[model samples]
Target: MMTKKHLALSALLVAVLATTAVQFFPKTIQPAGITPPATAYRHSEETSSVEKPCSNEHPEWREAQMIEGVDIAPAPACEPDNPYEVATSVKGTNNVSMMTLMQTDLAQDALVMGEDVDKDGDPDEIHIKLEVVELNGSSPDGEFLINTYPIAPGIQPGLWVYAPKSRGMALKNFNSMVAIPMLRAPSPTIRVEQGDKVFITLENTHYLPHTIHLHGVDHAFHNSKGEDNDGTEEHAVFPGKSHTYEIQPRHAGTMLYHCHVQTAQHFMMGLHGIFVVEENHPNNWVQTFNVGAGQVRHPSVGVKNTYSQEYDLIYQSIDKKLSQIIQNATDPRLVAQRMSRDYNMTESFENYFLLNGHSFPYTLRDGIIAVNDNENIKLRIANVQRSAVAIHFHGHKATITAYDGVDQPEASRITRDVFDIAPAQRIDLQLSTQNNGVNSYGPGLWMFHDHVATGTTSDGMEPGGNMAILAYKPLLDENGMPTMHDDLLNEVFSKDYYAKKQALWAQGDFKHLLGDAGLIVPPYWQIILFGLAAGLLIGLALVFTLKRKQA
Candidate 1:
């Protein structure tokens, strides 16, 4: 039992066990009175009168139900084989004239108004159908399912532009694939002519109640028969219902349409867009709506004669905490309770700013307002956000022609580089790109952004929010995308680069930052190091024990 070989083996075994135990059961320290952060999604204990499951409940389940007899179902998956096939069409007679709006092929029926009663080669009756849709739920890109926009790479809750079924038309059409619902903020811009009999039907497809209030536009409290047509708090269209708003505005300028119910919450939740009413002129057949914002191909007569191109810039700020409510709750009751009752509007803060629908680098992709030398472009800018926005043009001064859909007199119109737009205010500016150092500083990559310092940063990250460029055609790439200098392509400009993740950052160079080397070592190297240390300690212990035994 006291043999040198037996004692040495015993010492070696003890050292090996000690090393193994240290590796397996690492030390942990938790300070007293410390608590972890709360989880992102949480449920409240508030219960409704009827404790029913919210599997397919309407948004206003507690309110008195008004059956409009409309079928509401979840958006169907995109059919790969028959993606752009036309479903059916309907023919109907309106009060103004007998219209033939053809229903095109797509997921949502598009009312193609090809008839011209005025003999001006332009349709006089403007009919548009819109459905409320939820974006970034379950699928970020929805039917597209692909990374359509390479920039702004993250899942976030927002509204989408849905082409609903119109009278005498199916809901799906060819534009459905290109303009798929459930993408980003800034609801589709509704464009109409001054004298055109405008019929905008809103399909309440979302779980919540919504109404399209034509803000600052010419409309009465009631229709011709004294029916409640004014989209206000009283006439809230509940889910699964539909409402057709008939208005023929005489004035022509930039207007707005948004949900009036729960003003502070719903409007800020991205339920508003630019509503442009162009002057009634000969051959003025404007595209009823621009699903999301971009170039207006067929400009109005006034714009066509004056400006070469037109762009709609919808400025909005998002409170991540408020918008995330939709992402957190799956049930309709929970969402309604949290959004209506629990959520505090006073504590709201802006975390993200958007121009059109996207932030900075992404804005450069689609939000770029490309201009040619000596071209006059009409900029219909609207401030949908709560705070006042000071819009500044980098290299040129713009002439303000209209304010709040009302034209300013020529003498009163001011030419300024920075235009101050208050909340719910719209400004129509005529940007002259003469490039003679007077109208503009000669066509280069000029930036157009909010002068408010915070508006330029996204979630407190600089050079990452509502910034866009007004670039000359010469400065653009082969694909018509604007080309910026490498200085703007820094690590901090990237969405994931600021977070310091190796995968999104420098993948090959920043390997050391991936893990804590001291805390987490390679398995093979760790085993070798532990074995050598244990063997050396065991040998020393054996020598010491033998010396002591001899003594």
Candidate 2:
């Protein structure tokens, strides 16, 4: 026998009780076809923080090291110093430390040597296994949501590159225990001797489908089994699948290999690399794959006879808007849709330029061509960027020997300071470190960079892009660091410089005239005008309010 008012109050109380119950035990509404992020990948908090011992003797017993706050045993003096530690040595910079990828032997990790048929010494049957890897992409469970591989200081653009199929954690030279997939780009250079029976396998480890088109490499349109040997989109290898491409290259020169599926987007995202066919020679054990393109530590027979050192220079540019789409979500479908359908390359513009997968300062770490006073250096240059690059040498001119895998005639070889290479074109240059003025201007620390202006900048910041030094042995320290003058390194290498926190001419000769004038104040005349405008607006508002009250 409750009144209507009492019944309504009782109902209200019941609703409040139900709401409190729901607060204690809430149900989640999961979207259809979309998996929860936590189930997708393990988050960074789940990772262990134990300090592990590093041994040069047992290099195989190594683990992947987290680049953050990494404190472990020092690398062996015998091996190359950890480029990661070397890069972050500059004070007042929080640049992500480079992965100890160089520690993992490039020759062994990338090249699978097969049986020597003729038995001159080196293996005749070459097998190269490559896997497609996504870099700087987000994961539901990762510490930063994305595993960021910064190409330049404070700039982490998402990229996908071809990496050699490596197993387990990197054992040596790493500071902490991290996975062993040496994910990097301007993907590994495939170096094989002419007439060698090569089997190039594409292991599609990523979520999307991909193919490797051997551009300019001599191969049949179809394989023996009549499969698409041309590596076109017609025969793409999907995720969790693999395909082996067989070929015996007839020519010997620099060529190219890249994904043919969605070529415009895929190529820009960094699936292409230099494919080199060395001159046919007995016992020519070439460093089959130059992962993270730089110096070829083990020179081929023909190269050894011609040049003192060999380098693979691949230049590329990133359109930030397109490359950054992958970082916006953790789902593969969403990213793929955005890149393939939503992105318009014609409307976008390239921002970050790279030389062998790194911008400047970072380039100084491994991109240096350490030369003696009178030495001949062979440089295999490729321009895979959207725009053409006018590569200029600061202190010397180089002689062009080849173009697009074809050797230029001795009479046709041209020597110049700047060489203009178009998109997808390869040019071979013979750099002479002779102090004879024409070829060499007596190199102290000669810088070689793209003269396209934008090519020398990382996101519009000068001294931040594809710039490297041709350091003479004398100028390089025992650790291979160039003995540069002044506090130039201190200023340029800091994060604040790139972040626009510090003024460009704060330390320059024109500091007094052009230095930072913080918190700029408006002129007295402008301030007076603003005050009069404010008074007028206030007077009008008061008049309107009084009229409304009278009404």
Model 2 agreement with the true structure over 308-347: per-residue lDDT tens digits: 7788999999987787676667678897899898999889
Q: Write the per-residue lDDT of candidate 1 for residues 1-551, one digit (tens) a residue.
A: 24777666866686776668557734332111111221221112111211111112222221222112111111111111110111111111121122112212222333445367788756777666777656533222332221122124232333333434433222124332212322345776777777767677788977888888999878767766576777888888899998888887888889998888887888888788888888877766455555456555445677879887888898988776776666555568887898899999999988778887777656665677878899998999999987989999999999999999999999999999999999999999999998777679997989999999998976666565688888887886644445665434443334343222213333334445754323322345556567667776776777788778888
TM-score against truth, every candidate: 0.70, 0.74
Clash totals for all models, in order? 10, 8
* Among all candidates shown, the one with the greatest lDDT: 2
Cα deviation in Å at residue 416, candidate 2? Answer: 0.9
Residue 329 Cα positional deviation in candidate 2, in Å, after optimal superposition: 1.2
Q: Residue 373, candidate 1: how far off, in angstroms?
A: 0.9
Against the unseen true structure, what C-alpha lDDT does each candidate score?
0.62, 0.69
